[model samples]
Target chain A: MRKYLFIYKSEIMSELQYVFNILIGFIGYVIILFIFLNLWKYIYNDPNELINGYNMNQMIWYVIITEILWSSLGGRKLCRKICDDVRGGNIAYNINKPYSYIGYSLFSHLGSATIRGILYIILGMILGFIFLGSFPNLNILSILAVLLSGILATIISTLLIIFIGLLAFIIEDSNPFYWLYSKAMLVLGTIFPIEYFPKVMQTILKYSPIYVVSYGPAKLFVEFSWPNFITIIFWQLIYILIAYGLCAILYKKGVKNLNVNGG
Target chain B: MLMVVKNQLKISWLSIKYALIREMLNKTTFLTNIIFMVLNNASFIVQWIILYSLKDNVGGYTFKQVLLLWGIASGTYGVAHFFFKKAFSLSDTINTGKLDSYLVQPKNVLISAITTDIDTSALGDMIYAYITLFIYGVTLPNFLLFTFFCIIGGIFLTSISIILSSLSFWFSKSDIIADTGNGLMTNFATYPDGIFKGIVKILLFTLIPVGIVNYIPVRVMVSFNLGSFLIVIMATIFIVILAFLVFYKGLKKYSSSNLMMAKI
Candidate 1:
């Protein structure tokens, strides 16, 4: 635990050095948010018209919350690191270390993300306020639920990314897999709610990782309900087990294969 | 002057040829990248389709017009990345002093630098663009006009990247600035311009130039406007010349990394 804390602290300190870069990166997010604001405004035509059960304000805020979750998770960078390590034979060096590689990855990523996530959320909320004239109405309990679900979503996202990276054991590059997964999340979950998808896709996506990783937190934030919270928590628990179980199996098999090849 | 231009063209052609061959060395990865990129880009269209199903038009853009907008955007991006991918990464090349290789070579440094690599996935964008056009009803004139506009838009996009990246001459970490600028261009290029009004619309035309890249092209293609077509051509030429001037001016401040490397 202490070792992991040290790793986390180190990552946060290093990330802090590039504060300007962090801010610059947010420019893209802001521009996309601006476009969405205008787009939803144009689409609504009437202020009171509800599209897919969401008012224009709710729709834009939904996009904001989901984008925040997506950006702050740092799954792409983590997945790239794992893919590079496995492909470059650097994973062999880490396997002999005292700490669990998966734990190290998770803690370090979360530590780096903690600062970034907070900054992004604050920026996103400011943008939301500026565009929509207010923030989402939420009680303290609902906000707490959103935060908890967000953390679980981040973990599940990171685990799934690690699973994709582990595919390097079989394939030469795992980026294509990551690309497909990310597009699914972006199209199905982040940019629009599942309700906005086709009826068939909505049903399928509800059972997929997109439901837990992105939709759950954003959905709870916009319109909190006990039934939805319970459902999301149940999905999160299942995804956690599946992600962990898959990673363990793949990591063991991958390391053994690497050893046999004298890597 | 003609002789110089001819020599530079030959050198650029050779650089591109070698880059393509190098990429082809990993044929499987190349094909996978192209295929997956097409699939990824197609997913965005699916989202738009869903949106269109709910409404007749977005910002006065019918579903078919939206298809043309994407076709132009993806096609222009394809031309830039497929031919001169290093234009986007020019800041890193300048900051890290990787420009040393081009300097040592006896060719047009800017041309050589940007033409030295091919992003295979952009080929997918090119194919996807043409497919979208075919779906939008391909006529002989429409096909020719679309291809011409794509070339103009591609040049404009690359010029924007070059102008932004040339800031590395004065700033230490201008790469981030360049990236943000490029991101803005890409984000704005995809959306219908009718939604933006007043100052934002003006800025899009002058500063970011997404208007020339997509909006002007889309409008010209739809209505055959001679005035707008000429404006796009002139803007593209002006930007290209400006990019050259900025890059050469910055070359005076470029210091070498002193690390020995070779262009493959």
Candidate 2:
């Protein structure tokens, strides 16, 4: 635990040096969010119109929050590192390290994600203010709750992406699965709320990662309620455990067939 | 003059043909790449489907009109990616001195460099575009307009990429600008034009140029207008010429070894 803490601390400092790089990457988020803001503005004909119990303010805020969480987590690079480690035989070197491979990867990436997430939040607030002219109303309790949910959401996504990367041991390419997972995240909860989905999909997605990973934190931020927070955080906890177990299982099994090419 | 034009076209055709053949060497991978990309893109449409279910109109677009927006976007993106995929990587090529090999070639350097590689997955985007067009409803005139716009949009995208990537000659790590610029163009192109107004809309046309890529062309397809079509043509020509000018001007700064490119 202490060693993981060291990694977490060090990785934050290391990732901080790449602030310029991260800012450049934020360009995509800025564009996508701007487009969504425009889309939502054009959808809600009346400024006070409500669709599925969300007002114009909440709807735009929903996009801002989801995009912040998704981009900050840096799900793409997380999987690539894992995928490359598993496929490129770097796992052979990784397993012999002092601590758990999963712990090391999780904490280090989390450190990086923490820096990126903070930046995204600041940017989101500024963008939100400019685009919508108002912020979502939340108290101190709601703010803390949403922050907790966001952390849990990041953990769940990280564990799942690690699990996907470890799949390179079993499959020719784990990229396709990663692609499917990202699209599922993007389409289901990131683009819009689960309520916007068909009733059937809404029910199914509630039990899926869409509930914990992408939708949960944003929902909390937009419409923070005690029941919603409890439900989302509980599911997030369960999904993170499940994701962790999957990675442990895959890693234990996968290390057997690992091959190293060079001397 | 005519002979030079014909020869350049022949060269581009051969370059694309060979790139395609190289990609097809792995049959299963090639097929799966196309298939998977189509599926990947189709998933985004689900968002629109869900949105339209609750509302009759969004951003002044009917459901079908929105699909046309998507179709034009898809078609243009596919054409650009499939035909000039290397333009997207022009910064990397410049950074890594990948230009050395192309510089030695007998044909045009920019053309040879950009048309050398093909993204097989882009074939899926092309297939998806046509599927959406068919779903929207087809007419001979509409079909012709769509095809023309695809070419126009592809050229526009390629030029944008080239112009952005050419910045690598003057600066380190300029791929960031190229990538972000390209992303802005592609992302904005798929969106409904009515949603944007005032300065942002103006920026899209003049600075980002996504308006020229899809919006105007989509207008021509939905309701044929000579004026809009001519703007598309004129803008595309101006952008392409600008791309050439930028690349050539930057080429004078090219040294065979850039420290950044040598980083592996």
lDDT of 1 by residue, B147-257 (tens): 998877888889889989999998987887788888888889878998887899999898888998899899988889899999999999999999999999999988987
Error of 1 at A157 (Å): 0.8
Candidate 1: tens digits of C-alpha lDDT, residues A1-263: 99989999998998898777678778878988888888888778885688888888888888998998888876778888998888888898888899977878878888878878888999999989888787678989989999999989988988888899888887767888888889889888988988987788889999999999999999998888989999999999999999989988998898888842354
Candidate 1 — what's its lDDT?
0.87
Candidate 1: stretches off by over 4 Å: A259-263
Per-candidate DockQ vs. reference: 0.77, 0.67
Taking the tens digit of each residue's C-alpha lDDT, what string does model 2 give over A51-139?
88888889889989999989998888888888888767777887778999999999999999999999999999999999878878899
| Alpha-carbon DockQ of candidate 1 | 0.77
What fraction of the true interface does each of the listed models get right, in terms of native contacts kept?
0.78, 0.69
True contacts kept of 1: 0.78
